[model samples]
Target: MKKPKLELDEPQPRKIIRADKAPTEGYSLVVDGHFKSHHDTVEAAEEAGMALKNRYQMLQIQVYDAVTKTRSMIEWPAPV
Candidate 1:
């Protein structure tokens, strides 16, 4: 007797931040400097801060009106 082959696959969960409509007013994303781990949301950011050894600082982030795509960078004195 021959056995049938089995296929194994798993899906990974990820966070998606979407803007249905562009905001007339600009917004800011502040990440704490003490944050160490990778973050996908504000809650994750806080978790990263708690995990870090040093004091966390707020990182100032500015969203541009013209740009359609979002971009991120590592800044000193991170924000929460």
Candidate 2:
């Protein structure tokens, strides 16, 4: 039997900081699953995430390190 092909749905709006190698940079900042920019360090990427929060009012942010394969999340200004 043959199987059919599958396609994924559109991505949702979100912020992410993660390590990357394809760009030849140290790390990258992504928004809504789209590459936003690259940074020299993860810390710089985190700063970009904060900037996204302040500028775009994003409620949540996710950080991932490809080197360590670890992930974390940041909540922008705890909901009141």
Candidate 3:
């Protein structure tokens, strides 16, 4: 007899302007200065971040490159 799991083991919390770099080997999805998760490629990281960005639209999300120690901000274009 064991209790059923209600949620999967996934990082959902995201947000600011974190300047620190990730220590992991792959690209990291940083939300509001926090490392949410890591991806094998930049495309995957951006895609994941975009999902969150599209939902909230205000959270500051970025993809941190562990090798380059650089981060790129992701955003949606303003409505014309």
Candidate 4:
């Protein structure tokens, strides 16, 4: 018997690092549909996400780019 392929739906907008243009191209970190914090650069936003994940014991954290409209997941280390 042949197996069938599964199709996944396009991912929706989630936690993202929104790049603000009006007041400088700063990046903001969002989590669980809420605006958490803002950073001067994307790297800072990513680092903030990592800290938040560890501090809150989040299962997973996703990051999206406001300008490019792309998404990525934050890699979390396994608990010791």
lDDT of each: 0.39, 0.61, 0.82, 0.62
Per-residue lDDT over 1-80 for candidate 4, one digit per residue giving the tens place of the 0 to 100 score: 98998879978878554334322345555566555566676787788888878887664565556566554566676334
Best by TM-score: 3
* Model 1 C-alpha lDDT per residue in residues 1-80, reported as the tens digit of each score: 88987866766777444443433333323333221233345444444443341354344333232234353443444465
RMSD of 2: 12.0
TM-score head-to-head 2 vs 3, winner: 3
User: Model 3: per-residue lDDT, tens digit, 7-36?
Assistant: 968886784334464554779988999888
Highest-scoring model, lDDT: 3
Model 1 reaches what TM-score against the true structure? 0.22
lDDT of 4 at 51: 85
TM-score of each: 0.22, 0.49, 0.67, 0.50
Model 1 C-alpha lDDT versus the unseen true structure: 0.39
Q: Model 1: how far is 59 from its true place, Å?
A: 18
